[model samples]
Target: MIKRIIRNTGLLCLLFLTIAVSQTSAQESSNLKEGKVSYITGENIYVRFASTDQIENGDTLFIRDENGLAPALLVDNKSSISCLCSKLGEHTFKLDDIVFGRTVKPVSEVVQLQQELPEKDVNEQVLITQEPTKESSRTQDINGRLSMSSYSNFSDEADNIHRFRYTLSAKASNLSGSKISAETYVSFTHKLNQWDVVQENLNNALKVYSLALKYDINESATVWAGRKINPRIANVGAIDGLQFEYKFKNMFAGIVGGSRPDYQDYGYNFDLFEYGAYVGQSKKTENGFVQSSLAFFEQRNTGNVDRRFIYMQHTNSAIKNLTLFSSLELDLYKLENDKPTNTVSLTSLYFSARYRFSKRLSVFGSYDNRKNVIYYETFRNYADEILQQASRQGVRARINYRPVNGFIVGASAGTRFRAEDPRPTKTLSGFATWTKVPTLNASLSITANLMQTSYLDGQVYGARLSKDLVSGKLYTMLHYRWVDFQYVNTLTNLQQHIGELDLSWQFSKKLYLSANYEATFQEQQLFNRLYLNLRIKF
Candidate 1:
């Protein structure tokens, strides 16, 4: 398995090298349009229309395809340059110059500015070319998958569980003119029993929907709007909101609704939460891309209880054998809850960055700070909180090195920062995952945390690892995790461990079945599961 991963990675590296070595235009365009780019803001580029009378009001701007022919967007007197410049770049921008969009366009007419006036009104389409450009496509595709697992122990009837998940989506686009699109997703999961008289369990659900339209107002920019997904990411790739994103130039701004699975309320409410907004930007340099974002959140019912934050991410590796990605975020909360239990308003800031020394080696570090609003008392979820002690600042980093192609070695030690309490708890975590192509997948992950909070319930240390073996039509997976809790002020001592394993068989590409077993070290036990997967795109 390790050898396969190595070989595959090598092939991918070679592919990237080939792509990096070749000029993007040469690789993607048959013939190039010898025009200049203007209004360079962040990652966006707008071509200024020149020397053409028909090129008025964001018009007369067309792009050349493989055939060496260009499409044009004639200008109109009513064109608003500001509105045009506002929709210039993004993953889902008005143009198809990049591969981020599921939809494609051919005319390449984005309206950013109008130097002249055309006979046609601003909303009227002008024909700058006798024939349409040779390069054009129309189609939009959306796809994704979801999975859930549960562990059960039938022996002591101690560890029992139940869970489920699902996802669905669709899209459509037109390349010749403005495009319209829509998509939605839903998911749910829950544990089965409370292990008779031992435990308690619950289930939850999540749903998402987004719609949008993009119109090239001219040759320089596109205007797009709709309820689309927002990119309010934090914690690397660990968090995001499936809401709206309003993008423009080197920046985009918009809102989103609830997003979740934040475990400890550390994340935006994922429930049928209120709306939020996010803006972002990316740029091209001699080396790589630079990305940044700002996000704001509101309650689903609209009152107050807002969680807003601005984050910046810089990515560059234009160098050799190295890549860098870092992020900084400040979270502001406007708590409106009148309940006294609701502590002070708070602001949390965090920063993290990682450097890849090589495909197999990299290191990362993170830091965070939190402060309460008004009286300056620490934001506490409960009494007996660490007041000044809750104001913690710490740094944790680790290095991952892979000497051989298949096996990787990683070690790390650091303190985990908690947002609510704003405290740094001692922690050490490490994980390694290896996938052997023909049939096996294995990973070992461990997390150790020693609470830094002041109360009796502050200490918690846990670790988890899982392994899966596969052969032909059958596969088996095993997972285990343990936690130890302790506190200085009180005897809130508890140690627990849970383990589970499951087997699955794929009868064919469209059919599959699976079962699982789960067990806890003591108290509760339960067996869980069955699964089915089907592919139907038509």
Candidate 2:
């Protein structure tokens, strides 16, 4: 009986090897195809650029950044694009003339399959299985502070300031392989700063600022509501939106809220709210898999008119230890009041990659191309020009290393290309930090960047911005706290510095105290913020 079992196991192993090899070979052949672009549902487009690339489904990708420099890829679908390729960590592909950019609706729910265990004698085969354990899939963090602080500024106003900020969050696992979570952020400030009304309001308001829920249908899929970071649409990650994330095997997908349109003159400025959706995939291995994502979003006001954005991306790793990725984005405005509010198509493309020559040294860079085609309106207001949405391409590169835990150092540089203009702005920056101390932790970071930026209208020019972020804290087993610092220099020659010291102590379970002091500097004016807070269980 044992002998028979051994024979059966050997046969199964042989079969598995054959299938795995064949799958790899087939993917390699597809990636080797020269000059062809075909979107494979669960993977990236099969490419055969220059004839010598070996790629496969789900392989890790490494390539150059856009501008045909660093490492990156193009995977967006809204903008019309041709002649593209990607780095697949150890392979590359030439995007042939094909359908790589297009809109696709959501598909049916993914079917859940039961795990299957093959019958085999334990003595004959070695089984490598991941350990299963209970997961703390849910968590809640509370930030409370208590202290005494005072603020004195350029003005003789001796108004006392008190402030408080708090947050609560929770999460739970879902049956569809998804998880659900929610949170609320609240702030309170009395005797607010008069310099920036909006900033002051935000700093002093004690209201539930945001709430969110997440639904995961599978290991690689999700849909969410409330507030989320808008990815590659309208603005980059900072713009939060009501959104969704989907991952089909290796192919990718998403949709997020877009920017709303509002006019300040003639009461035209109505807070414009935008929404978007996108899909794409990426390769993370050397077997020639691909990485990409396509997305779309829109803004709506009563239904009379709206705006939209489409984005796509693709990336892979190639030879020479190079990684590459690229992206394309489009912005469109429409009006229900008329035909389509004026429309502008802005297309952006960039690529980047990095190479590690040693354990602590490596180089990376990226290039961008942004072109905005306006259908009609071009105005002459400096604010309009400076604040107006901008379209430009640029390049960015960085190199860094870590000699040990809690410490890192690096330097980076970047340059921009404007669509409406013909000049480029460049910049360079460097910084370092360390947090090796236990119980007490601290770190400092600084960066300097220079490039061309636009105002409300559309014209690109040179400017420089520098930033410094730092944090420090010390505590024992019963309590702990930290201080925060920040600084920013604008290209319009506007400069500002901010410093804040805070402390928090937990007297015992369910009770705490916190306090903070802040100072701000802009031009020749100086301002400050002060607050103290406490919490206790009844």
Candidate 3:
């Protein structure tokens, strides 16, 4: 297995090198153009061009910032004079940043219609061809963040616990004007004072969240290797091997071949080989946009068929002020008598929608009929097992209303039903927030929750206050909550109180620090926790 992996990796590298050389040769023989950033919005940046006739939808654009040229935008929608772009990286920009578009193909390849034109038409054509030309250059942007956190916990029955965690995330792309790119996110945690119980679970203290490399063969097709999650098919989770995708107009198709991570600790293993394929389409309408995808996957455990399923997802915003999303998974393979059999069964379903009635009012709702995820290796007790096995069919709805400026009120309700369970669980919650207090530089919020189930009923009340001390540099928050629970069968009641304080400081544009302290009191016992984190971005 290791030899095969190495061989595959080598082959992919050679293929990418070949493509990069070819592209470089072609680019040297062609010309390029430039555009200028004209406007910026919360979700998109608009670029103005002399004439956007050469710009394509999937083309990439680089923005010149203080850190040099960075390929930080992707062109999504365009018109003859302007193009809409979405940011691909975190880069702050002001007005009139120089935007460099892709290299233009050779003019000889462009088709021309030769004819005897009128005298007036020839003059207009010559004027149109006299516009200024710009040169295209390659971009290399390396940026990411590093964070370290320390956590300490104190309890009555157990010894004081302390842990330190460090996380690193970075991306280096288009290095030296090549299409090669690599990204990784990894974290590790260590216990300051190891205890027997803690040591038993130390195997999970290190995790490699993602490590992937991508090679863009061209504007319309790309390939990726290693463990990475594809945004278009996020429901399928991470793929551990290779993925290839191609785009056409408003549609895309892709294939994935990989091995699933080990079941015990999410590490590498050859027994869980899997493969899948998906196709999707997206389009923008007069009102909004919509996208949908369908995928089929198969998995094996030690050369034996383990699971096969089909997944479907859809998202829509074509209706004014309304957004909708839904996804479904259906099992296509079942096991009987230690043999695989064909069957059709709905495994999971989820749907969510939101609508804005006006500038001051909005509502959102969601429904899910998926079983709760269960990890047998991590189960601690019978109650945990029971909760994992319980069917997680539930529906929730929330609404927010702003009666006046700087003040908002919201309410939510939810219910969950389990199969063969006579009693269902229901909950209701409400909150009110005042962003700008009359005489103070602080915001305040109050919330209440009521919950009922077959075994227990509870009520919780909470309040929080937050203030900005130094405009955008420093902030502080304080919160308190009270909870009361009543057991139905035993007719017993319990009460608890909790409090927390949080502080954050932004020292510079690329550095931040935060600290949190929390305490809980129940039945004459107390528990406390403290957390501190520091992060730096590049």
Candidate 4:
């Protein structure tokens, strides 16, 4: 049965890919339209229109202010009703500034207008191609996803267990142009035949990922209330109070005041008040761009200082075909002799760089020296505690080559070491992908990895076949993997096999459904999982 399923999946992949490739040219047209700048916060400008369905990342829009059309703005991201834009050059803009998408006027009309206008005013007339107009009808933009999953485990020595989980994420904005936006995410999980435990752990099962409202006070400033995560200072995680940001040319500054979530269950905790401020600068160089930010945070518990730290992050793409990113966290407060003292200590550091030698070749490397993440409430086992104490300091390097169109080969190596350990864990991997298989219109990838650790060694190999069934409407993928592990001290060996199948269907422009099934086998043990998700966009 498994073989039959695999064969059928392969046939479908090839058939779908063939149709998608043949219809690619017909889907190249766009329906983008003009939008107006509703508000601006720091370098992030919010442009709103009737619908953002046709807008896409990297699209350019001309911005017009009192001084007429200024520089263009690049659409960095978009939601259902708004597009987040960044300035492409040194152009000053204000609130309610007009923005226009691409529009073409008839050559004959342009010539007539120019001929009738004075030479001095010809340029001004030429600039009046199109202006952004506000939509008469106000509509609230809403989008979200709901997902459910089930897991079952089978073992010879232990009774079978089953678990169910559900997750929800939603975002709503505009709400009749009141300039209000809110987003939220929550999840719940429970084991089968464990109603009592589920009731007892209800609080832990439900987590409010984000519940935030954003309001634009003016052109250059905005405030967010409630829990929100800011990408500018994402290393600080989520903030539970207020966030304010302002922009000045190529520089930006922001401040956040909030309380950290409860460490135990990720719930609201008023006693863990925290506040921070950050400054960042960004500029485009001749070849690329550079951005950097620095922030300082202070956290207090019960009105007493609990932690103080400084974070710095920087990214540079100023060199052609190359990118560099680095960040560091330093603790400013430490406890000594049961007394708090100001002492600087590096807590975490990461650096990464990627360089594309050419269209067909690229290399990337990274180094990370950070302590392992630990959840105090969940650290019940000795292994978990030991792993927390073992700092995960590692370095990885990878290279990829594409000798021909739709074909790629890559290799990578990495190692992790701890100060207390004598030997480091090393890993090596290689992979190949062929999107164009001669006359077959399908994609296939194979990957293999070998790992050597102080206590054990392992090898893993996998393959995947995937294709888009109906252009952007439907997709399918099948994957299989084999793993072998050998314990160095115990002289024990184990092998496992895993297989997965995934399917996604875009029922319409606003609705989507996806499902996944996975199974694993190891000797007499078996594990299975099923997942389904539904998403909607407005």
Candidate 5:
């Protein structure tokens, strides 16, 4: 397996080199903007950019890995110059790592009335922004970022640990202003004293998330070869073979054929072959836009059908002050007691919507029902339920109000339940932020959360202060949180205090550095972690 991985990597590198040599002067200019990862907590990652002018919630962000410009982050919330994002897959990221977001959408009147659409419509929306240009196709336009970082952990009960990581991301779109384009993202990581682990299995320390080449046949059609995730068929994951698409007016269609990556190590696995086709339409109304897509897919293991399914996605914001999006997947093939069966089963469903009543007030809600996707020929031994009920079905709602300039408040509630579970899980959270504190000249935010589950009941309170020490060049933040919980089943209580400090510095247009430290104090023990990073962009 290692030999095959190395051979495949070499072949891809050769192909990329050949293309690079042939298209030295074919690049064109781009409007892509750079952002750096600043903080990661729970499932959210925060990024600081020059400005959020053209960036929107639900937009996709790219990162560098061994493969190429793979989709890594999904923008969930944004302020003037910062965004809150969530990981798209299993990819891990570090502070000061660079991310790219293109300036595509123009501010529309509908934006004042409703929130943005979901990720399912992100690709089509970006495509709509790529109108044909009159400039020469051979002008060079290139952008990318590279970085290195280290992480350290100290604990009272365990030995100290350290790790280092390096990442590279680049993109040459419309290379030399021609029809050719290339993208790649790659990363490598290793422990402070574990060189042998990397020497024995390089895949353990290296990851290639994306690498692909693209060519535009015309303004209405395009083709991509190599490993890439098609924006239109993103739910299908990355395709390692070929993808072709054609657009007619506002309607589009595409086909993809590829092999799934190795399930264990994320390496090449041609034996896990798959293919699918999708069709969708996008239309811009005077106020907003609407898009919808449908797809059919099948996968095979060793030439035998392993799974088949249908995927559907839709988003609409044509109505003023209202936006809606939904995605669904239905399994079409199943196996029972070693017998082949063809039955339609609902595997996943998600629907969300948001409405802005006015500039100061808005509300959002969502529902989710998901089950484990089955791959017949791949995992016959893992045929039972392993996922928790809380992840399978849930509902949530939130409301935000900006009563005055620089002052914003929001509250949210969520619940999860199933027929087989005795108690329903519930959570309530609220936050208030003052963009500018009168005496401190800094922003302050306070938050609290109350949560109850079958096993525990908890309440958390937190406060944070952030400031720019040297305007655009330096910044700092301080945070503290207290957690208190009681185990309902065990009748025990627990409490802890956590504190954090973050600092960032921009030395020049292409250089940046950041440091972060955190400590957790409990009644019996204390834990501390430190991270430092240096990044360069071109």
Candidate 6:
């Protein structure tokens, strides 16, 4: 199976390369669009622009640093005037930071627009694009990263386990001045002595996360084939067939028809077919923007309806210094006692908001409620108890305040509970950080956490210090944490001390190496873990 999948992937890759190399166009034009970081949540970075009409998913955004532009963010999702991106490499971004996007446009159009617009507006947000000579070549912008990592674990209670992982992610947009673009991310992982397992299921060792070819039908319509995830309806996961999207000014619509990956091993599964459609609208307000999407989907197993659901998402940031987002999913089909019925049930809901009170203070809060999603044909044997207890719902809130130039403190509290569940989980954590010490010139942070669950009560205390060894080239950090736990039923006490050391080096603009070592010491046992990774980007 691995060989077959690899052969297919290789052929597709070759075809893409051939097409990219053979295509040629007249003199190319370039325009720079500047945007600002507006909001960030976990891995999602939101940037606001005058418009994202020319931006596409997987495009790279560059950091507007004094030294020059460097690759910074990968566009993951976008609305009319905003983009949802993920950070690249180890770059750090904060609110209001400037970023730039390079776009292909006609030089005459840019010139005419600049002449029509006022001087102040053009100077503040846009840059003039000079016409290229007749001999100028089209830009085949490409971004890619290849990395390998090793993870090793050793403990006195069990045999050591070691695993290695290799991953490659690349995106080639507007290939060779053509409308054709391709994006893929693939990974291979295996354990040191797991040949038998790999032989049994090659899919387990090799996984093709995404491989898709996209064609821009026009300025407002586009189509994609192969395996790709539609960020507008991300909850649907990867679709293995075809996707079509069309935009009309601030309103847009999309349709997806495909088979879901195999439920067991995430491999291709033609038996599980699905289809969905979604519609959305985005508008830029005076202060920020508002976007909303609604989608309906139905999945089938061997031509039988396996599941049906509706997904809704909304984001509003029109209020200055505030942002709000929410999503909801409702199951429309269910099976009970061998009988199929259509009954609407809420399956998942999430809402979050953040407000920046001032330059030195901000607060964030979120609520999430998720229940076990049932598929009639997929998991028909699941027990009632198993479904009833499979709920994880929680609420969390945090506040951060910077008292001085280098000193900052923050705290967060969270709780999880369900209607029928007897025990609840609660957590409280706080941290104080000194970004720069007067004499040592190193960053230091102290943290404390308390957690209470049905099984045990625990407390953790930790501190970390980090410094740059060679300015922008090398860095290191040292951290120590102490943990104490008390069993609820056994009334037994346990304590552990953990120490970690981390080192990272940037050999060049595109090459990086990092290593981490951690050790945990208990009364009668010792555990050690080591991780190493090397990455190169082009």
TM-score versus the correct structure, for each prediction: 0.48, 0.43, 0.72, 0.70, 0.81, 0.75
Residue lDDT tens for model 2, 1-538: 6635633543353344333332321111122122223211111232212211232211222221110111123221111111112221212232112111112212320110001111111011101111122363433222211222222333334544432233322122231233553332223333345436445433233222233355554556566654333332323332234566655554556666533222321111224555556655444343222445567666666654455667665544433345455566677765557566556677566555545554345566656564432311221222223322221236666666656544456655665555664455444445443323343332223333233443211212211111111111112111111211121233344444545454444455335454545555556765665445454321
Give the C-alpha miss distance for residue 133 in model 3, angstroms. 18
Model 3 misplaced stretches (Cα beyond 4 Å) = 1-138, 195-203, 373-393, 420-422
Residue lDDT tens for model 4, 467-533: 5566655667688878787877896787878887877766665456667777778787776656565
Per-residue lDDT over 16-120 for candidate 6, one digit per residue giving the tens place of the 0 to 100 score: 643443343222224777666754433335666656789765566776321134456656455455565644322345544557887864665433321121111
As a TM-score, model 5 comes out at 0.81
User: Best TM-score goes to which candidate?
Assistant: 5
Candidate order (lDDT): 5, 6, 3, 4, 2, 1
For residues 1-538, could you state the per-residue lDDT of candidate 3 as single tens digits? Answer: 6945753564464345434333331121134455556444322465655556777664657643222333455565555545556443223343344577756644532211001100110001101011111332446556655789888888986799888888666665676768777666666677785555335643366455566777878766779898776665655655689999888787889999998766676656667999999998877655555777899999999998889999887766677767666778999999889887999999988777766676466676778776555342231222222222321348877776768655667777788877675688887778776655666756667887777766777777888776667665676778887878787889678787888888777676557777888887888988888889887666
- Clashes (N, CA, C under 3 Å) per candidate: 46, 129, 0, 0, 30, 0
lDDT for 81 (candidate 3): 49
What stretches of model 5 exceed 4 Å from their correct place?
Answer: 1-138, 371-393, 419-422, 491-493
Model 3: how far is 406 from its true place, Å?
0.1
> Which runs of model 2 end up more than 4 angstroms from their true locations?
1-164, 174-210, 215-225, 229-248, 252-277, 287-289, 315-325, 332-344, 347-352, 368-394, 401-410, 416-426, 431-538
**Each model's C-alpha lDDT?**
0.35, 0.36, 0.63, 0.61, 0.68, 0.66
In candidate 6, position 510 carries an lDDT of 58
lDDT of 5 by residue, 1-538 (tens): 7847655774568457445644443222266677788654433466777667788765767754332344567665566666666544323455566787867534652243233333222222222223345453454556666788888888978898787888766777776568887777667788888999898866677766667788888877788887777766666766778888888877889988988766766656788899999999888765566778899999989898999999888877777767677778899998899888999999878777767676567677778675433331120111011112222347877777768766767777879887875688787778777766787777677887777777777777889887767766788889898878787888678787878899988898678888988887877888787888887766
- Model 2, CA-based lDDT: 0.36
**lDDT score of residue 489 within candidate 4:** 80
- Clash pairs of candidate 3? none
